[model samples]
Target chain A: MLPEALDAYVAAAREVGNPSSLHASGRHARRVVEEARERVAAALGCRPSEVVFTGGGTESDNLAVKGIFWARKSTSLSRTGVVVSAVEHHAVLEAADWLGKHEGAQVTTLPVNAAGKVDPARLGAVLEAYGEEIGVVSVQWANNEVGTVQPIAELAALANRYGVPFHTDAVQAAGQVPVDFAASGVAALTVTGHKLGGPIGVGALLLGRDVAATPLLHGGGHERDVRSGTVDTPGVAAFAVAVEITIKTQQEYAARVAALRDDLVKRVLSVVPDALYNGDPVDRLPGNAHFSFPGCEGDALLMLLDANGVGSSTGSACSAGIAQPSHVLLAMGADDDRARSSLRFTLGHTSTAADVDALIDALPAAVERSRRATAWKTPR
Target chain B: MSGGVDSAVAAARAHEAGHDVTGVHLALARNPQTFRTGARGCCTLEDSRDARRAADVIGIPFYVWDMADQFHDSVVDDFVAEYAAGRTPNPCLRCNEKIKFTAVLDRAVALGFDAVVTGHHARLGADGRLRRSVDNGKDQSYVLAVLTRAQLDRAVFPLGDSTKAQVREEAAVRGLAVADKPDSHDICFIADGDTKGFLAKRLGATPGDVVDARTGERVGTHEGAYAYTVGQRKGLDLRVPAADGRPRYVLSITPKTNTVTVGPREDLLVDEVTASKAIWHGAATPIECDVQLRAHGEVVPAVVTVEGGTLRARLLTPARGVAAGQAIVAYQRDAAGGDAVLGSATITAAARTSVAPEAARA
Candidate 1:
């Protein structure tokens, strides 16, 4: 977290009182929380009343997915359809899966293009077929794995025509791109801290004033009674500060990180000619570079790179710390071999040219050794 | 590392020896449970976490390689098929041959690792010969004998010189959390230690008859012939006993007829054994040596001969309870101390010699 955000957090943490309490200290705590909520609202282009604080990105996604589905389905038993893009984070994918398994939800997973994009026409076709039954449609503003920026406005507009609630997990897009909750034409938008240089365990579900979502937690009627928990006052304060600071400088940060990321991709590709750069080349996130090294296992490559002091990931490490073939890549039409051979390198706000240089210096040997490892045949 | 003290200490020793060490735990289960509800089984989520913790303490990079597909195809499938064919296959031996040596070792070498280090208690001599560990009770040479000479060349056994107790002591001293972890026993994938139950789940129950080998009369019934191993005495559930009032041992299992043959204990004895797919580590025959029939079974003196990729061994002493699919590892007793591993083959058949043994004559 940035120093300014940390200061706000530490200051808020030292004060005593519940935001819900009625005493003097309680009122004081309530004022601090309300002010933080307004700052977050102003930063994200949403109303303070629309911003409902929750634990983080995962929690916000669950609320928007399950809560919206439940509320819509409850009002009309026919609204049993839940549509989501195949490239969504597990938090959203698994939430849709749960509803399908237990709540009689018919989940229609919209496939993405080779670039990992959800075409608006695909959503329109699904809505045209089952618009009345479809309770909600969710496509992430930007993918967490491949960093493909979706045309959220077009998608939300399409869903709006069908009278279906549209939600976006904007956790990865908030500070890296222009995210205006009010202008996005979605009923709900998910944002989190940590990703925007704020503290962990604090985020917001920006629900449209007219959007009806059932409460996931029920106690003391907090956050418009849609989510109930003792407010994380300090985390909220820090998150708002992070939001204010990051939005103010989003363009400059994006440009700088994008430049470094470009340099990394260029140099890495030059050294390994056959390596395929993954995701949407033109519409990718500023700070992300993904690649599929032919004949290399992503996990082995990641370990070799880590040993060389260059930390990277095989896109996603599952619960067992075993790297499964990337679902996003598979959805993007890559073969199983290509999917398992991919690696994701993320350049954060703190990254610099030197960091890119370190990666470039380490890539060739790591890739070569990894390829050799994959080429080994068992003598069975 | 298997979330056990021996592997933890082995990793520690290798790191301390100044080699760039990387700790790896194989995720051999397709759907590993979040935690082990029972004390048995490896490859649980808990085991992965334990391995990660050990890596953290050792200050080395760690990874869990998903070898589940390979393990399932090569080891688990082969085990079931062997049992279905009425042979008592050792999963550990199969695992060592396929997973630890072939799959994992090949991957390690490809990744630029000089060798794949394991915690098995068997020594690789400077002469490039594999020898029994000084700790006789824990020697794993029998299971490891399936590995070819090339696989052995790339394998390192750091814990071979230390006893199990010494390994635990070293682990405690190194502050590895798995210091007190109990040793894994039986078939690791069989979480409940019920071989019959595990096989029944996969192969299903095929009703068969148990026959008295002496009289060739049906004496009992079995759920599946695969459930009984040669030389098994208990759990026969026999309907009738010997007229002399003695217990019957499982003489043989014939999957073709779905019959488990049981008879007097003397009927189980055999002096001649034949094995197929012989893998010679370094030693050749016909040579006089000692042969170990089971994982920890005592070694009996024998003259072993090889021809047509099959090995024939004549035991100097009559052996009992020898089973097909068990590895017969031949070892030459070194004048210095520990016995050196010579070769191994999977026993294909066991039979009584054409002539009566000296013990029977006496």
Candidate 2:
């Protein structure tokens, strides 16, 4: 967390008040929440009325998927199909899966191209063939693992043409890219707090006023009767400061991190000549440097690097410590071995060139030993 | 870890001993069965869940390391191939040799862990020599003898001093959910205890003649020679009794001709056993010791010697039912360290005692 966000959070955490209550203290809390909402709306190029505060990014995504699909059901039960990109986060994908399992929602995961982009032509074709049946279409603004940025404006325009509600989980893109909810023309945009130098447990779902979405929660009818439960007044305050600072400095932050990331890639490639850079080389998140080491398993490499005091992540590790091959890499025509070998190095605000120096110093030997360790398989 | 009370309590004890312990359960099988017939079989979904629950209760970080590839190649496939060669392989020993002590332990060390800890009922002395567990009923040193000196040095077995009952009591005290979980038995791959059926499915059935080894008289037919193990009396389904009117047992299975040889109990007595793929710890020597043919089988007196990585054993007392492809684990029988495992090998052949005069009827 940034020192500014930490200070704001600490200062606000001392106060005790509920925004839903009608007392004088509650009025002050309500004022703070509204101010935070206005700041978030201004930063993201949306209206204050459109920002629906929820617990976090996952809850916001779940509400957009399940709630929108349920609302569409009331108008036309025939519209039960949910269209989502194959590279969506588990938050959106699992929510869609739950709808398919029990809520009578048919899901169609549109495939992606070699760049991890949902092919616009494929989405257009699906919209033409089953536009009337597709209750909602969702594609992430930026993939978390491989850092491939999606062409959100083009996809959202197509969804709008077919009159289907479109949602974008911009949790990874909000503070790093120029994310204007109105400009992208998505019916709903998902953004979170902790990912943007704010406290956890506070986020917003920017729902267009004309768009129709049912409520996922039912108590107190908070946030324009969409998301209920006591509003996190302190988290909202901390989140507003974070969003304000991140958006104001996004361009400069991107330039600095991208330079460091490029340095990291150059140094690492010098050490590991056969390492394959993943995702789109030209158009990717500025802070992400993902690579696939040919002879190394991502888990082994992660452990070796972690032992050397460098923290990194594989494509997707479950709670069981099982490293599943990246679906994004597979969608991009990578074989199972290449997909399994992927490692993501995400540079955040706290990242520095010294960290890159440390990673480069240990990466060559780490990869060499990691490959040799698993290579001693006695012949069957 | 086996996800049993022993491992859970062992992990708790290690943590209590001020060692920075991490609980790792080996995911040794792909597509673990969601429901197992017996109590908490290995690599089942229930076992993984139970392990995670125990870790949670113990307040330690828990992870399930995927060892399915290594296990399938080393233990499971090796088991099928060994049976195909007419040997009764002990998959538990193979797992202990390949999966636990070698692959999992090496990976743990590479990942900055000092030692690999498990729930096996064996003691590792301060001098790093492997010893029998305090409870002989639960002694696992025979299977663990295949571990090298370096592996034993970096391994910790906290349940060595405690009996199975004490381990369960410690698990209850630690609030582990698997305290009362029943111990798993038999081949883990053969969950239903139907090794013949499982092998028939994988290796396919080949009809073979079951003949009397003494008189060469045809007894019955079997679906597959790979389905029978030496000294097995049950499932023979012989039509005629032995010439001496005594029960017969399987003496040999020849995969080449798909033949199973059965005979009277006297033919099953063996005085010599030879083994290959011998692995020795400490020193290789011609030593008089006790050889255990199977896990928890009888510890018969023998002179076990290793010559050029092959084991040649002369049983001081005649032993019965010795089968090829079973592990012949040599143990020290001296009073100083009773039944301490010396080394082991996979028996390739055995020399039977001379046929008894009373059983030589045509």
Candidate 3:
């Protein structure tokens, strides 16, 4: 799968053309970019013009959030605040926080349910009360850690009612679920390449024609001037191919990945009886499983699995090498012990049933060893 | 359970003892931003990962406990307060007494565990008595002396009988990731080994005068008395030198007066010290035993007499520079190759010695 994406990337890299240039070579480059854009739009069910290229997921999120917020606030002094869900990715949440701290922007973070999903009704009430103050309402399409899929359509509908621009970070949900940008009624949507088996360092911010966005990076007038930078032609081409393939095979892939995830959950729980499964069981992502074993540490489990040739994730990969507990878990109301005891196993295009089997086979012994090494004795 | 060889072995021993064991690595750091970009220490992200790896090798359930707030309140706050009061404090002692044995143990009990175990190099006798470990050079009884009876009852120290080398060998044998993990020293919170700097950062320096006891003259200017400990010598830039051309040692720190007193080495020695907040491990009454005033100091012979809530201990031999706020751990010889800890007390005061020419001969 990786080879295929690389092949497309290599072919695109050989061509020399600037999508924005008017020369013959530039026109050729423009064709390649346009073709990729059309493919991505077709997959996401949005107009080709709506797809705006950015550096990556983080940049895309920044552009969508800060862009819309500034644009709305510029129109009216009353629209000076940004409302976002509590569990948003740092790209959205931290940007809002930075704006609040440095740019005099007020931010109201809506709460999430036990499953890490936000309620549209609660959001609507918040909008009714502070709608004039709210410039933009942002919620993630899905949570990266727990894999909880939020009700984006309902949230967008409510935001639309208040004439507030709604943005969703669909970075994790783009290929895993059916994300129709038009049907969702969101002003802006974020999707990244790497999450969908595409090349890294490339993603897009889908902006509706009516949506107004202020450019973050100022340079050459690329990405319709909403995001100014040299276009990553190869990365964009690979991403387009990956998105097209992912969308075509999404249903079958979801079925297979969900089966493996469920199997893993069953096997892990069976071996470690007191394991606490995190996130929404049914409404979660198809290929993600998060569990907290009462006595085991997440890092210990991850290492144990790694030793046996199985790879997994714990908390955010950004803070990869650290032994710190996940803020996401903490924000979801997990106590210190529970938050520390958790591990996340995410499946991708290359994951298979055998991989799940290997994990199950190595689990019991690893858990036993980890428990012994820690000598963690809880009082009866 | 798994990070270091000792903890790994301790977990193995507990499991061998037939108890349902689980490994836990506490995440005491509040934010990853506070961690040194690349450093190793307990509660640091790297150490936690190493610990987790060890737990996995041992096949135990592993967890990270978020004790950031608790750590700040207990260890960090206590350390700052101890320094502010013109005393040197051991943060490891406070962490063991508060977080590890108490908070972690309480949570373990609530989770239906039989006991909380650690790799502390201290022993529990057959009669369930707390004693020094077999390896005298590696004995860690002083830091653990602050544990109460209730805490000791639910605690297990598995590395008590084993040497550091043996623990490493066992970790290698078990294929633990932290088999060769370096032993972490220095204050965990002060990642750069700058205790004085840490104190200064926490407590702003209050300018004070360093005075000579004999001449009654201001010899040097110091940032604060609290910054200087009882025996520190090199950092004091004194303009006046001793008659013998020896460096002046910090004899006393008076936070109330905001003055630091410097004198000869002999002036720092004291024959008697009074300790408050005495904790007797097993016995209800105070007993005479050898006491170690510092973590690495010699165990000098002393007679402990309790009156009300305070303990007055008179050293049979002259001990040097016994500072207030140091722990005086009492130890009695046991049949099992080492001494058993009787109790401990925090030194509240050191009695001034009046020089007597004839009495020194006696």
Chain A (alone) TM-scores for all candidate structures = 0.98, 0.97, 0.95
- Fnat by candidate, in order: 0.79, 0.21, 0.03
B172-247 per-residue lDDT for model 1 (tens digits): 8999999988888868888778888999999999999999988888888999999998889988898887778889
Candidate 2 lDDT over residue span B219-310, tens digit each: 89998898888889988998887777888999999888889999877778787899988877755577888889887888888888898779
Ordered from best to worst lDDT, the candidate numbers read: 1, 2, 3
User: Which residue pairs show collisions in model 1?
Assistant: A373-B110
Quote model 3's TM-score: 0.66
Error of 1 at B89 (Å): 0.9
The CAPRI category of model 3 is: incorrect
Q: Interface RMSD (C-alpha) of each candidate?
A: 1.6, 3.3, 8.3
Q: Write the per-residue lDDT of candidate 3 for residues B289-341, one digit (tens) a residue.
A: 78899888888887877666577888776677677888888888676557888
| Candidate number of the best DockQ | 1
DockQ scores of all models, one per candidate: 0.66, 0.26, 0.08
RMSD of 2: 4.7
Q: Which digits, one per residue and each the tens of the lDDT, describe model 3 over residues A225-284? A: 787877888888899998998988888999988988998899889988988899988888
State in Å the error of residue A318, model 3.
7.8
* Two-way lDDT contest, 2 vs 3, winner: 2
